[model samples]
Target: MSLLDIDGVSVDLGRAPLTRVLDEVSLRLRAGEVVGVVGESGSGKTTLARSILRSVPVAAGSLRIDGRDVRGLRGGTLRAWRREGAVQYVFQDPLRSLDPGVRVVDSIAEGLRIARVPSEERTRRIAAALRDVGLDPELAGRLPGHLSGGQRQRAAIARALVMQPRLLLLDEPVSALDAASRDRIIRTLIALRDAHRERLGMLVISHDIGSLAALSDRLVVLYRGRIVEDGPTRQVVARPRHPYTRLLIASVPVIGVAGADRTERAALRAAIDA
Candidate 1:
C-alpha cells in the first residue's frame, strides 16, 4: 500500500454553487518517493495540500495515511491524528508559519513535545534537527526575527522534521527565497530526503517547473482546478501531453532566442500545432 493516498478528493468554499476547486483529484505516494504537483496560481495545488493535512475540510472523497482512511475523522480524533505526525506541512512563507517570539530550538522542540518525547531526548533531537537543516547549534536560542529568511525556513523544516512524520507536504517551499537561498534549501531538502528515506514520503507543490523537475520522481500538472497531465518527470518535461502543459513549457524564456525569433508569428504557429 502507498504511504499516502488521496482519492477523488474535492474541496469548496461555502455554498457558492459548490465550485469544485479540486475535481476528483487522486494521487498516491510511496515511502521515500517525492511527488511534485505543478500548476499556475489558483490551480488548486494549495487546496489539495490543505485537504490532505485536514486543515481545509474535504468536501468529498477519501484521504488515507498508511492505509488508514481519514476522511471521517473529527474533533479529538483529528487532533490526535495530527499530533501523531501522520503528516506534516511546510508552508511557502516560513515567517508566516513560525512564531516570531519563540526561540528556534523551542519551535523545533514543540513537535517532540506533541509526540511526547522525553525532555532529554527532545533536546538531543532538536539539536540534531537543527544540524540536519544546516543551521548552527548556536542559533537555537535565537528568535525567528533575528534569523535571515533562509535560516527561518531551515527552522521551519527542522520543526517538521522533529515530528518524524511519515508524509511531508511542502507548499511552494522555495518560492519566497532568493535564487541562491532557494538553491541551498533545495539541496538541503534533497539531503534530508536521502537521510530519511525509510521513514518519509513527500508531496511538493510548486509553480517552478525546473525546481519540481529536479526533485520529483513523478509529476502531476494541474490546470483550471483539475489535473491535466500526470506522468513520470522526464516524460512530462520532454514530451508534455496536454495543451496547457505545452503552453507552460513554451512560455519559459529560452536563451539564445532572439527578439524576432520570439515574435507573434512564431508563437502563433507553435500554438496552432500545440
Candidate 2:
C-alpha cells in the first residue's frame, strides 16, 4: 500500500465565493520514493503540500496516510498526529522559518518539546539530525542569524528530521541556495532516503524541472491546479506528452531545448481555449 495517498482532492481558499486553487488532484507517495511536483508560479503546488498537513481544508475527496483517513481526524487526535511528527514540512526560506533568537538545537528540539520527549533524548536526536543533513553538531549552539545560507537551510532540514517524520514535504527546498549548496542539499536528501531504507517517503515541490529530473523517481506536472502529466522522471523528461509539460522541460536549459518555441506556446493557448 502507498504510504501517502491523496485521492481526487480539491481545495477552495478564501471566504464567500471560494476560489478553487486545487482541482481533483490525486497523487501517492510510497515509502523511500521521492516524487516531485513541478509547475509554474501560482499552480497550487504549495497549496497541495499545505492540504496534506491539513493546514487547508480539503473541499472534496479523501486523504489517507497509512490507511487512516486524514479528513476524519479531529481535536486532540489531529493535534497529536501533528505533534507526533508523522509528517514534517521544510519551508522554502530557512532564514525566515528558523527563529533568529533561538539556538539551532532549541529550534530543532521544539517539536520534541511539544511532544514531551525527554530532554536527554531530544539532544541526541538533534545532534543526529544535524549530522544527517551534513551540519556540524558544534554549530547547534549558534543562532539562525549566525549560520550561512546553506547552513541555515540544512538546519531547517535538521529541524524537520529531528521529528523523525514518516513523510516529508519540502516546498522549494533548494531554490534559494547557490548552485554548489543546492547540489549538496540534493545529495543530502539522497543519502537520507537511502539511510531510511523504505521507512520514509518524500514529496518535493519545485518549479525547477531540471532539479526534479535529477532528484525524483517520479514526476507529477501540474498546470492550472490540475496534474497534466504523471510518470517516471526519465520518461516525462525524455517524452513529455502534454503541452504544458513540454513547455516546462523546454524552459529548463540544462534539461531540454534551450527555449520553448513561440509557435508551441500559441498552439497550447489555442488548445486551452478550445
Candidate 3:
C-alpha cells in the first residue's frame, strides 16, 4: 500500500462564499520516494501540506495515510495518531518551530516525551537524531538562537527524525538560508533520505526549483491551487509540459545572467496576470 494517499481532495477556506484552495488534487507517495511540490505564491502548496496533517477542513474527496482515513479521525483517536508521529512536519522557519528558550536537546525530545518514551531511550534517540542530521551532541545544550541558520534547520530536522516518521513533510526547508547554508541543508536531507529510504517518504514544498531538482525523485507542479504537471524530476526540468512550469524554470537566477532571469520572470508574471 502507498504510505500516503491523497485522492481527489479539495479544501475550501473561510465562510460565506468559501474560497476553494485545493481542487480535486490526487497524489500518492510510496515509501522511500521523495516528491517535490513546487509553485508560486497562493498556489496552495502549504494548504496541501496542511490537508495531509488534517489541519484544514476538506470540503471534498479523501485523504488517507497507511490506508487509514485522515479526515475521519476524531477525538482521542486523532490525537493519538498525531502523537504517534507517523507524519512529521518540519516548518520553513526553524527558529519559529523550535522554542527559543528551550535547549536543543529538550526540543528534540519533546515528541518522545509526549509519547511517554523512557528517559534513557529519549536520550539515545535524541543523540542519534542529531547525529543523523550531522549535528554534534555537544550542540544540544544551546538554544535555537545560538545556532546558525543551517544548524538550527538541522536541529529542527533532528526533532522530526527522532519520531522515526514514515512520511515527512517539509515546507520550504531551505529557503530562509544563505546559499552555502541552503546547499548544506539540502545535502543533509538527501543523505538522510538515502539512509532511511526503505521506510521513509518525503514531500517537500518549495518555490526553489533548483533545490527540488537536486533532491526530488519526482516533481509535482502546482499552479492556482491545482496540479499543472507531474513527472520525473529530470523530465520535468528538462522538458516542462506546462507553460507555468516552463516559466518557473526560466525564473531561476543563473550565475552570470541574473538580470535576464529577473526580466524574464517579470514578463512571465505580467503575462500570467493578463
In candidate 3 the C-alpha lDDT for residue 198 amounts to 94
Runs in model 2 deviating more than 4 A are 259-274
Root-mean-square deviation (CA) per prediction: 2.9, 1.5, 2.1
Model 3 misplaced stretches (Cα beyond 4 Å): 253-274
Arrange candidates, best lDDT first.
Answer: 3, 2, 1
Single out the weakest 10-residue window by summed lDDT for candidate 1. Answer: 253-262
Model 3, residue pairs in steric clash:
none
In order, candidate lDDTs are 0.83, 0.90, 0.90
RMSD, candidate 3, Å: 2.1
Q: What's the TM-score of every candidate structure?
A: 0.91, 0.95, 0.94
Q: What is the lDDT for 63 in model 1?
A: 88
What TM-score would candidate 1 get against the native?
Answer: 0.91
Clashes of each: 0, 0, 0
What is candidate 2's lDDT per residue for 3-72, written digit by digit as tens?
A: 9999999999999799999999999899999999999899999999999999999999999998889887
Candidate 2 displacement at residue 27 in angstroms: 0.8
Better of 1 and 2 by lDDT: 2
